[model samples]
Target chain A: MKLTILGCYSATPRTLNNTTSQVLEINNHMFLIDCGEGTQVQLRKHKIKFNRIKHIFISHLHGDHFFGLVGLISTFRLLTREADLHIYGPKGIKEVVTLQMKLADSWTNYKLIFHELTSENSELIFEDDLVEVHTIPLNHRVYTNGFLFKEKEGDRKLDINAVEAANINIAYYTKLKQGFNVKNNDGVLIDNKKVTTPANKPKSYAFCSDTMYKEDIVPIIKNVDVLYHESTFLEKHAHLGPKTKHSTAKEAAKIARLANTGTLLLGHYSTRYDGLKAFKEEAQEVFNNVELSEDGKTFEFN
Target chain B: MKLTILGCYSATPRTLNNTTSQVLEINNHMFLIDCGEGTQVQLRKHKIKFNRIKHIFISHLHGDHFFGLVGLISTFRLLTREADLHIYGPKGIKEVVTLQMKLADSWTNYKLIFHELTSENSELIFEDDLVEVHTIPLNHRVYTNGFLFKEKEGDRKLDINAVEAANINIAYYTKLKQGFNVKNNDGVLIDNKKVTTPANKPKSYAFCSDTMYKEDIVPIIKNVDVLYHESTFLEKHAHLGPKTKHSTAKEAAKIARLANTGTLLLGHYSTRYDGLKAFKEEAQEVFNNVELSEDGKTFEFN
Candidate 1:
């Protein structure tokens, strides 16, 4: 899986720093997360293909989180996009987006499907043969949710030399990959594990932003390959985190440490701070593995 | 008068080119016109003082014209702006803007005044001692209007030497500036023209965009010092102009010629062409004094 950070700064979008937006490419799916203002321009600047995005996930109704949504929809209409677009967001997202379309009188030619999410518990939002997505309820000033994307376990891999030595027919290969015992060409029962080996371990990623310090979320994102958490403040301004319902660098690292994530990625920095060095240093004090997310940066997990 | 072109492209914003938005500074007032997406960032890139803008004029409800308005408003609230902001646009603008604010649960601490216009005739919408603004109704796919900004006549410049030679009292300077005949210290009636000359001719500017080749608006914007009109296509693609409710460069210059404008400014070029050379050459064919409006270019009129 590869993740590209289109924007990572918090609050206002500046010339050098952008707001929250990321593109996650996993299992042939490109998912857009938390499109802030100027996200479309950032996407163009980064040379991301607009048509590849089929699903968009929004965290909340904050202006900094989803203000670019209407513009992107309209641009899609202008470009005459024919594919269906799915949007997953808070309950009020549909009303806000549809109202703008109604006023402009420029309805999209393509199908626009809205999945309004209102559940406060962790539940499966999307699932397919290869991947599953679940919602992680977050504590913020508004109704918000973080998404957890996990790759499903794959079928076992066949050892060709071992299968041939066992006189297993090609027709039984499918059954063997499914971990089932089957009769070989010699009419003898064969064990599934003797001819096949288990597939590689699946990888998972969790994205959380604009939330306060909540210890209950550690279980939902436990043992993920990568975890991206918002750290809107550093230790110097840690006092301002609770009032704004935002988390500090130390708080995000504490959650990552409890969850045992392989890598902890920090983002959504407030513009008041001059540099991002303090955040990484502060987060490293709590978690052993830490990474800082910047605009136009990319991370790959194998 | 100074006009800064923040963005002047026709449709969707690109990596380098932007959509429609401009800043007009006349007689100490900063007016924002047609805020497209990414306008807030453009404003920051240009280093414009955000607090100086008190009024915003939107041409219509098209996404390319006004999609960035809600984001700018939210930014103002984030900056804790206490000044009143006045917005003038179509009848449905209030509902569209307020709905987004309601969903986000973010209201401005400053007063937001909306002047919803539904008139089809040219009418005076704003007036003060220094400047007067009028609407020039234009023909388009949607209800639209072009703005006309005219600087009001200023106080007459006193010929200081001539006033002293005429023996006019200093107490009567205000009357003399108002073009009134005042008695001198010797109680002699003095002629107004002998002591003071007329103020510099009041300058005017008209902005017309996203309209077809309609000649009816020529009378409303006639004799303006500067005229900025949309030229979305060239003569090669003039056939597509009427269907899209856009105009060609040659067609815009024809209106400038008929209206006797001082300088015809061409903008809102479609992204199909590479350079702006064709637009300027085509517009210059019909009008002697023509200027091309480019992004980040400023035009000053004295």
Candidate 2:
């Protein structure tokens, strides 16, 4: 799995910093999250293929989070895209986007599908053979959600020497890989565990942003391989977190500690902060495995 | 009058080129014209004071022409701007902008006034003591209008020596500046022309964009100090100009020549072209006084 931070700063875009947006490549799919203004330029600057973004997930309707979506969609149409694009966001997203297209009198030649998410409970939003995505309800000034992406476990690996020693026929090899014992050519039952081993463990990633520090999400994101949470403020401005429905670096670290995620990635720093090093320093006090996200930064997870 | 080209390219904004947007400074008023995507960043890059832009004129509802407007307005709110902003555009602009703000639950503290234009004929849209802004109707796929900004004639220069030689009273100096012949203290008429020369010929600037080659606007923008017209393509792609309702550089030059504009500024070049030199070269074939606009380029008119 690979993750690229196109923009991580919060509120408004600046000459040197951008608002919220990122690209995640997992299970052969590229997912765009929270396309803030100027996301397309950032994508081009980072050399990310525009058509590779098949699915877009928006956290909220805030301009800093989703204002770039319409422009990106329009650019895709101007490029004469043929692939189907899916957008998953809150209920009002479809109306807002379609209205703009209607006014401009320009419609996408490709299939534009909207999956409006209204459920507050944790529910599966997207699933395929390789991956599954679920929503984590978040607390914010507006309707918002965090998405969790998990890769499905693959079939067990086959041990060629063990299978040949067991005299397992080619037809029974399929069953063995499925972790099932099958009858061999001599009518003797063969042990599947002796011939095959378990596949590699699946990895999962959770993205949360623009939400206050809430412990309830811990259960939903527990034990994820990587967790990205917004740290809009530092400990010095911890008092403003609750009022603004945003999280402090210390609060995000506490959530990371409670969820026990393998790695904690912090992003969406408010522009009021001078530098990002303070966020990492504050988060590290509570969570040892903490990393800071910067524009154009990339991370690879194995 | 001063004109600054924030972004002059057409279709889509790229890392190297931006879409249509400019700032015209006339009579102490900074008027923003056609704010395309990424305009705020462009403004920052150009170091334009945010508060200086009090009026925004959008030619049409196309994404490339006005997508950056909402983001700019939202940024103003974030900055706690107290000055009222006036936006002049097509009829649907207010609904489009207000809807986004409603969805985000973010309302501006400053008053945002919208002047929706629906007329197909040239009409005065804005006017104050120092300046008058009139819409120059244009032919395009969508309802569009080009703006003509005229600096109202200023008070005639006080020719202090001439006024003293005429023995005009201090109280009558104001009458001389207002182009009125006043009675001297000795009861003799003093000619105003002898005391003050005519004010610098009121400079006018016309902005025409996203329109096909149409001659009807000639009378409206005639004799303007500078004319900024969209030339999305060169003469080589003249066939595409009519179909797209855009003008070729040669066609823009034709308009400039017919309107007898002081200087013709060609902009909104299509990204397909290799460089901008071709646009100027093509336009200069028909018009002698021609200028090519680049991002951050400025033109001063006296």
Candidate 3:
């Protein structure tokens, strides 16, 4: 899985910075998450194949998180997209987008589907053969849900010596790799694990933004390959953090530590600060594998 | 009056260009006209006082014309704006904006007033002492209205020399400037016109965008100072002009000539064209004074 940070600044889009938006490429699916204002332009600058983004996951209704959605949808129509586009966001998203379409009188030629998320519990929103998406309920100013993209686990390993001894037929190789024992013409069983090698391990990515520091999500995202949580402020403003329901760098690190995720990606810095190194230093105090998510930056799970 | 063109391009906001948006500053009132996406960033780039923009006029509901409105409203609230903000647009605009606010659960502290326009006839939508705003009924794919910002005939010019010749007392001079004749103590009637040379002729700016070349509006914008009309395509594609409910440069200039306006400002160019000189050239074919609107450019109506 690969992740690209399209924009990650707190508050509103400024002359020099953008709001929240990111792209996650998992199992060949380019999923856009949290589109803010100017996100379409960012998509163009990043050279991401926007047409490939069939699904969009919006965490909440914060302007910074999803203000750019309407523009992006309009642009897609203008670009003459033919593929069915799916949007999974908080409730009322359908009204906002459909109203704009109704006002413009420029509806799309392709199917425009809206999956308004009103559920408070974790549920599957999208799934394919290789990947599955689940909502991670979060505590925020509005009904919010973080997303978890997990790759389906593959078959177990095989033993080459056992396969040769059992004289497993080449036609049953696939079945053996799928962990199914095959019976040869000699009436001998060839154990699946003894004939096939294990498939590549699956990876997971969890995204949480504009939410308070909630540990209830730890179990859902525990041991995930990559966990990106918003760090809107620093510990110095910890008191203000609670008032705004935003987390500090230290607070994000605490959650990452609790979840024991492979890596922690922190972003969504407040516009008040010019530099973001302080956040890195603060988060590093608790989690060693914490990385800062910069605009236009990309990360790949190893 | 000062005018700033934040995004003068037609259609969608591209990677390198934006859509329609402008700011007409009249009598210290910052009036935002047509907010396209990335308009807030442009507002910041031009150092515009976002808080001072109490009134926003949207020509229509096309994404290119008003997609940025919600973001702007959200930004204003995030900035803690206390002043009441007024939005004037087609009917159903209030529903679109307020619903987003409701979903975000971030209502503004400032009073947000919406003036939904549905009239097909010309009428005054906004009026103050120094400036008056009138709707210029437009023909488009959707119900649209053009806005005309005419500087109320300059607060009756003093005409000091004329006042002195008429022996009009300073106190009565105020009455003369108000277009009223006053009788002096000697029972002499001081003609208001004789005391105050016709106050500086009001300079009116008519904005007609996304409209067909309809000459019926000539009488409405007759003899205005400046006219900003949409010239989406050059005469080369003039065949599609009327069908699409759009105007060509030549057509726009024809309106300016028939209206006998002082200047014709051509904008909303189609992205298909690489240059704007053709638009100006086409307009000049009908009217002598024609200018092209460029993004980030300003036209000071001194």
- Per-residue error at B176 for model 1, in Å? 1.4
- Positional deviation of residue A31's Cα in model 2 after best superposition, in angstroms: 0.5
lDDT of 2 at A137: 94
Tens digit of per-residue lDDT, candidate 2, span B1-118: 9999999998888998889999999989999999999999999989999999999999999999999999999999999999999999999999999999999999999999999999
Over the stretch B121-170, how does candidate 3's per-residue lDDT look in tens digits?
A: 99999998888999999999999999988877664667788777766677
State, as a TM-score between 0 and 1, how close model 3 is to the true structure.
0.92
Residues B21-92 of candidate 1 have per-residue lDDT tens digits of: 999999999999999988999899898999999999999998889988999999999999999999999998
Please give, as one word, the docking class of candidate 1: medium
Error of 2 at B245 (Å): 1.0
- Better candidate number, 1 or 3, judged by DockQ: 1
The estimated TM-scores of all candidates read: 0.98, 0.98, 0.92
> Candidate 2 lDDT, tens digit per residue, A1-302?
99999999998888999999999999898999999999999999999999999999999999999989999999999999999999999999999999999989998999999999999898898999989999999999999999999999978999999888888789777778889998877889988888899987988999998899989999999999999999999988899998999999889899999999999999999998788899999999999999999999999999
Q: What's the CA error at residue B180 for candidate 3, in Å?
A: 7.3
Per-model RMSD to reference: 1.3, 1.4, 3.0
lDDT (C-alpha) at residue A37 in model 1 = 84
Best of the two (1, 3) by TM-score: 1
The DockQ of each candidate is 0.79, 0.82, 0.71
Please tell me which model should have the higher DockQ, number 2 or number 3.
2
